[model samples]
Target chain A: MILVLVETDAQGATLVSREALTFARETAARLGDQPVHAAVVAPLEESMATLVMKQLGEQGVAVVHTADDERLTTYAAAAHAAAVVDAVRAEQARMLVAAGTPRGNEVLAHVATRLEVAMAANVVAVDSVEPLVVTRQVLGGSALEEMRLDDAVAVLSVAGHACDPEPAEVPTAPERLGYTPSVTDQDLVARVARTEVTVVDDTAALTGARVVVGAGRGAGGPDGFKDLLELTELLGGALGVSRVVTSLGWRPHHEQVGQTGSRIAPDLYVPCGISGAIQHWAGCQSAKTILAINTDRDAPMVTKAHYAVIGDLHEIVPAINEELRRRK
Target chain B: MANVLVCVKRVPDTAGEVLLSADGLSVDARHVGYTVSPHEECAVELATQVAEATGGRATVLSVGSEDAVEQLRNALAVGCADGVLVEADADLLGPADVAAAVAGVVREREAGGLSYDLVLLGNDAADTGDFQVPVRLAYALGRPVLTGISTCEVQDDRLLARGDGPDGTEVFELPLPAVVAVMEGGVSPRYPSIPGRMKAKRAPVETVALTAARQGSGRVRLKLPPSQPSSVEILGEGPEAAPAVVDLLTRIGVVGR
Candidate 1:
């Protein structure tokens, strides 16, 4: 049996979780029809739970194990790890899969440490289950490493955009199990003190945006983003900045795109005045199409982009925005 | 006063193009220079600030080849007081081995009546991209651990850490004698000055051998990702390219023609 940890967002199961489910489904099929189970650590809110269950069922999960408790509402790594470990034991799962998101990776790390098992993270491909051959992203997605997990339970986290989420041809009704693992005072030692949610406008989130207009140090100053924002609005996308921009206090850190900030796989990414550092490239490398607008023709972003426009973005962005408006 | 231990890794500077070896077993470092990983640089900076504020000593540690002493000296030049080199083949050690070696150092120091109040490490190394050592070390030491922390403050006997979460910033309060895995961009690392470099060149880096058993994860091979074919087409220069950009956007379905 294979157990997958499914994490949900405000609306329902997130894209990364769905990706994990998809990965688990395919891996199970590859392993001669092994059963795939999903373990969710959440509050079990009626409607939310229903939505999650339906999604997991559609994804062909044989069983859905939910560790629903008041303390589980917020992320407590120890508590969540305990729940996953319990679920793994309950199902006698030989493989545990999770999304490579921050929470997914962190919680699974705790599980690995607690169980004293080996884990491979950011796995992009699974070769075989017998010896557990897998390919994982290393050096911040610059290279790939093939690894084999020799442990009894091969714990791994699939990289983002590794697989697409698809529903089963014939969906099955999954058996739902409510699991509550025993927790100790030591488990609560590193609990969340509080969470401050910064609500951005609906279209401003980098992950969900289909088009992203990126800015960098060449953006000059805070005022420089005005045209970029206009371009983003014109393109029906979000505004993303580089690490330097955020570090300079020109933009909020949340809007920064790099290794430390959001990793976006958008349909189109237009980087303006941004010299693509490897750290920044790690975030936007997954975009379907990249167009660089910069004055320097030899800039890394220019060389890496599919399309390049050589000019000052201050003049060029407004021109494009005006051209787009004129076409409209 | 708190005694902090900051773990740093010497990695190939990833700012330049990273090439793979012909054998595909390791990164081709013939052309690339080495530096402390960015996140670990920030960790050293944070440790320095924390020690300065609390009148404590910041000790930097690394488990790598003999040349890793250069990285330790760099850290000392930045602000660290002392350095320790756990002489080992970094390429042969997995996350578990690294954790065990670090745990051995911690135990040995504690035996010598020097107990660290806070242990700091990069959230993940840039080269290996392994997000394991900090948590594993914490587990080995039986200490609470926090990963991917961007902001941290020391308050009396406790520490406050903040990281980005799905919704917003998630804050964590950990008691003393805890482990923290710091992410980059928390603080800009300072460059080594002339006098600092001179002092660092003279600083003694205690070298020790790993008493812990080596752990292997059965790695098969390291391969470079297929080079993305990018044939950049110039859409013209200046404002005249605006129409071409619009046409391209429409072609990509980002806009309607």
Candidate 2:
């Protein structure tokens, strides 16, 4: 049995957590339909386990456990680690896996320390059975390093953005169970009063939108395009910024999509003025299609893109905006 | 008073584009120099400010090869009162193992009769780029953990913080003895001069807590990473490239004009 934990804030499971569930389900199927269980933590009143089951069941991993303990209002690294350690012990879980997200990596790492076992980070693929072989990316994705793990229980943090999100298909049988760990004075070290979740109340959202419009230093400092809010809203897509825009403080770091920022894998990724640095490419490489609009026809991002438009965005953008409004 | 602990990583300079040795993922000792990552610099910077404001001591800690000594030295240069090198020389562990290594330090430090009122760390190191250590260390130490912190301070009796959220920033106010991971570039770090750097080497740089990597591989060497990238060339046609450009533009919905 491989125990996987899904990290959800007050609103719902995070993007990377969903990917972890997908990874767990696919890995289980390959091993003659071995068991894969998903554990989630939510406020006692909320049915987070049920929420994960709805999504995980569709992918075949239906068994869901929720740590409804009162101590779990906000994510306490200790509390989460204690629960995972118990889950592994109870299931005699063969392996423990987590997404490479900040929270996932942290919680799993804490559990590994408690269990005194060796763990692998940034693993892309896994091959099981008697001393597992895991492939991990090193040197900024410039090289591949294959490592062998010889331990009773293998703990691995799947690289966040290096590998593609695996197919989410699970086995019919799910063994559902939940247990809480004995809290110590130490475990109560961190306290949470409340959690604030950001809801995309705006029309432009990355999840369901097909078109993604972005701006950068090329957008000319968030001022020239006084009607940008209108353009992106009309496109009915979320807005993203390049590293340069964020570095210059023209946009908040949250809006920057790259290896360090958000990894957006939408249907269409429009790169306006982005030169497509390797750091940025690793984040958007999984997108279905890429549309690059850069005056520099020789830009690296333009070459990797599905379609490249060679011209000044300053000259080209106004024309497009006019056409969009004319169509409306 | 806040007793903050910071874990720093010493990586070869990213901006230097330092040549790396091709074997076994080591940076060349000759050309490359190690320093605290920019993100960790912010962590130390914020800690120093908090100590100045609240009347407390900020300590920096690290775990790596003996090369980590240089990182500890760098941290000292930044105004960290003291430093520790875990001297763990092994392949980077997943977050779990790294946190454990840090916990060993906390336990040893705790024996010295000082418990931390807070812990600080960079959101992530640029090299490994793993944003897990701070939060995981908090978990191992049984402390409240906050990752990717944009803002933080200590109030009368509470710890206040702002961490990165989806659409906006989220504010957190907790009791003392919590953990906060500083977001990158949130604050500018201070520079240590020839005087500070030279003085810090002999300054109480302790190895109080060290988990020497389970004596596995003694091999040490680095391979140089490819330094050259494809250069840019203008396709010339200037505005005359418009015809071919318009077709490509219409394909991506950038034009109908």
- What lDDT tens digits, residue by residue, belong to model 1 across residues B1-257? 88899999877777768887777777877687788776898899999999999999899999998989889999999889889999988877788899999999999999999999999999988887768899899999999999888778789999999877777678999798899999875677888999989888888789999899877756788987887666888888888899999999999999993
Docking category of candidate 2: incorrect
Interface RMSD for each predicted structure: 2.4, 5.8
Model 2 per-residue lDDT tens digits across residues A180-218? 665555554553445455633221145335567667667
TM-score, second chain, candidate 2: 0.80
- On DockQ, the candidate that comes out on top is 1
- CA shift of B53, model 1, Å: 1.1
Query: What is candidate 1's lDDT per residue for A216-285, written digit by digit as tens?
Result: 9989998888999999999989888888898788987778787767788889999999999987888898
Ten-residue segment with the worst summed lDDT in candidate 2 chain A?
A199-208
Worst lDDT 10-window in candidate 1 chain B = B21-30
Each candidate's chain B TM-score?
Answer: 0.95, 0.80
**DockQ for candidate 2, C-alpha atoms:** 0.23
